[model samples]
Target chain A: MPNKGDFWEVNCYNNSLMYSHHTKQKSLACLALLFFHVLLQAQSPENDFLRSTGKIYSVVAGIVIVFAGLAIYLWRLDRKLTKLEKHINDEHETS
Target chain B: MEGFTDEPGVDLVKPEGIRFPYRSILNETIRNTFFHVALWMAMFSLYLVGLYHAILYLRTSRKDHDLWSEAYNKAGILFGIMGIATGSLWARYTWGSWWTNDIKLNMATIAMFIYFGYVILRSSFTDEEKKARVSAVFSIFAFVALIPLVFVIPRLTDSLHPGNGGNPALGGEDLDHTLRLFFYPSIIALFLIGCWLAQLKFRLLKLSDRVLKNR
Candidate 1:
């Protein structure tokens, strides 16, 4: 025992919910597709591992080079410091 | 205290002036480097330890081995949490996000949870031996899962995470040459500190065991 207006309102509400649900599902699917597309674009040049490995090697090399530079700097500084200390000691001994 | 020190081979006289290492002069602000890198190094090390224990536990079926594995697994998870916090703070300045969906970031989150599941699985078991053994196996699997989640899958997919998908790691570009001067040393020092902490925790466990045996 439902009036025509009541039936119409209920139908409208149900339709809206269904529409929203459908759009949400579609949106999720679109997102997944987009994610895959981005990944493909990123890796499209070559195999993923190859590209990543190259980057890793470059990073490792850079780290090595930087460390080498630091070592040289420290070594030179140590030598200079040693020379200064010896000079000061010689002056002190002479006095 | 003074009389006792002079009495024997033990010379406990304090030095006139304390000289700290050049690195120590960097101070507590430099502590962030330790706090950040140590956690990750510990996390990586413990994961390897857990993996080793898992294999041993499978071969020998020893409960103690399983316990050792579980302890390291727990430690790894704890360190992983610390790592995330430190990394987030570092990122707030560097990447400008409290959190990012970057590959490395997301993979780290996944890695944390995967090991956390090992703890959860351990809790679910009622029997002590069963819990240890089951958790040991789970830890191994979790480590395996971690490889793909962290290294493989993330790289295969697009990610903002450094060191993946042709993006440079946090060495040259992101961390400048000047920063690298401090950063590399910091990594080594922090790693040593992590080993020290883990060793201490392991020793504490052994001490607890001894006390319990005496009781």
Candidate 2:
């Protein structure tokens, strides 16, 4: 389903329009991956050095989760638009 | 500014303690002074701008003024929310919980809800003039209510947050000379950022209005 408050997606009529969102999607994914790597290190005994710094770093984890959620949301937006594009293209083909 | 060399009243050498205070429980998280506290100041500045525009909209009946007011209100709400998030984190470390029952926090939350009501009131109207008129009125009242909810009522009663009956704000050792240098700048910086966000929102609203008008 189309999401609410989708201003950019409203006027998407070309490939570049979709790719604009695709580029952001990748960046968001990379950021989440970077956080994942850091969190992985934190799980280890030897690499748990960040634990000594206190609760400030947990805010970083919260930020990572927010970015991850945005990435997922963008992926869903891409999928929804692609489905609509396919439907329109199929209709043109049958005609 | 970088070297502080030959600057009067500023210790060029290792003369005095100017770093963040080592408060119990607060510790290094006192660094949040720049982020959490400044955010509220920024939010307050944005809401003040919004309040001004709201009155202008009422006086001139210009749709642009109404939109500008709404934009600033939106930006103010965003900063307020971010302030809440950063404050929650700071509280977690210092207050030992994510939230607590305090006059300050509760009143601030109420202030936010009143601002949120402005948005709801704006969205409720389908007619352009009706929305603008009501939104302008609502935003003005929201900001007026915000003053007491955030600043006045909190000081009247006891609060775990600073600026309380006993714990006077901007008076303690928590904010030192070094912190003052960064904290004041952060408020202005974040206030500019909030205005920029409001400008962006205003553009978006104008675009949407134009698009819908064309249809």
Candidate 3:
């Protein structure tokens, strides 16, 4: 009787702890990348130099969009970190 | 009775502690993955780089370009070994075989061997300048041959390797969206890490050259 309850209790505890911290951080990064990817796709030119030529153009366009999004995200992240650093330095000076 | 009896005041000895950072993403095992993917990507990237150096060697007949060409060729071979080891482990899990004669697999093997011969050709020459020049020419030829062996040949034949003759490389039901989510990031991260390692290697080579000349 004790063993049965022990197994059930363990299962319940495991179910509650669904996502780990690492997985959460990875998910956030993925979401940021996907959001930028969608924005890029929407803003992409219809009569583009590569896309207008052939089927391979779509593949090329997709690659360009993904990389551009990645670049933009990295740039913004760098800027945010710089601002955070400056804020921290200002606080230190004030104290 | 003596063997079974415990000595008075005897204490169990514990092994030395090795602590790893809790937040660190890079571990000893994860480092292997970096080497694996980096070598493959570097092998591919350096092949292209060597191609450019080869062209320069052919057109200009400059020894510096030839030196760089030989360096890239050497780097490519080193990475190829890492790639094959990583791929063999990857295959064990995914393909249920350590080695397969799949079109892509065979093509990659041939491409690696072709570059291996490039190293052999360099060693065959005794004269420094002549060795570099001949090696550069061979590197260029190997680079050209790589295009067909690694890419075109695999694409022309049906095989289990991703993005070969039968199916699109990243497309298809095999690499579902779930896998792509992790796979794409892995590719980019691994490629960047590869470049970093190659730069380090090139710097070490330059330093070693200086040391050798001084001695």
Candidate 4:
């Protein structure tokens, strides 16, 4: 969990926000400081608790369904652009 | 659709191989950490990209930069809608409410409204230069406002969301190494998806502009 104080810096440290001089650069400076703090913390991964019997995979499945819909939207958009490009090409060739 | 791969890679499964840490209320839904949380991060990143392009448009007054600015903003808004929808569902299951008075939740709604205003403000002007200039300024102001509304104020106040009230949700108190395995990659994947959407929109915008010029 990240703290509320340096949360902005932590989120931006790795993102591609070149510089805003006024607003962005200041956040970048904060990102550098928080990067070190996250590194030094040690935590164990092992615990003998709940396993997959709880149907967590259903949640994952639902998410996949949502993304699949997004994929279809992209595919249709790509097809429309392709058709437009072909029309533009045909016009140029005839001219 | 015919050539589309169903998923990136099959999810790895083995008996007693690895497991996500369990919490009382968030037991199975902890897996949502990978998807729901990552969606918001991707939305934020796309907004930053939009903000960067808006700044470029203002500085150079380049037509290409203006198109790029609008394209990324559109992608960011799309992802933001997804994020809000997913978070609302998760809240319903976990927080027992479709919407809450939680400061973060309310602030996020306000942030979305601000971006929606950008779209409305941008579309009202028919003159290309005027649209670009005014929307560019609005993008800057909107992003500036977003930083505080989504980031600063939520943290300062008590929020039901983790990373508030001394509960860090990432790799902190709630997240474990096993969850990190899925969480980090999910954020990158969603971020790439947002970028791809922006690029597709930019290409379409450029082609339409060319068509208009030729006409």
The estimated TM-scores of all candidates read: 0.50, 0.67, 0.50, 0.71
- Pick the lDDT winner: 4
Local distance difference test, each candidate: 0.56, 0.68, 0.55, 0.73
What lDDT score is found at residue A10 in candidate 1?
Answer: 43
What is the fnat of model 1 with respect to the true interface contacts? Answer: 0.00
Task: Give the per-residue lDDT of model 1 (tens digit) for A2-65.
Answer: 2335434544544554445564877756655665565445434432321232222223333343
* TM-score of chain B as predicted in candidate 1: 0.67
Higher-lDDT candidate of 2 and 4:
4
Candidate 1 lDDT for residue A6:
42
**Quality of candidate 1's docking, in CAPRI categories?**
incorrect
Clashing pairs in 3: B163-B169
Model 2: per-residue lDDT, tens digit, B115-164? 88888888888899989988888887888899889887877777776434
lDDT of 3 by residue, A33-87 (tens): 6655544443254322222222223333333433443355346546655665575
**Model 2: lDDT of residue B206:** 74
Which whole-number lDDT from 0 to 100 does residue B58 have in model 1? Answer: 85
Q: Candidate 1: which pairs clash?
A: none
Instruction: Pick the DockQ winner.
Output: 4
Model 4 over residues A1-95: C-alpha lDDT tens digits? 33334434544654544443666677766764556455323111111111133435446654864586477658878897988888898889999
Docking quality tier of candidate 3? incorrect
Q: A1-95, model 2: which lDDT tens digit per residue?
A: 12222322323322343455665877656655655554444444421322235434544543443344335534654665566557556757877
Candidate 2 residue spans exceeding 4 A from truth: A1-51, A54-95, B1-18, B166-174
What are the per-candidate TM-scores when only chain A is compared? 0.43, 0.47, 0.43, 0.45
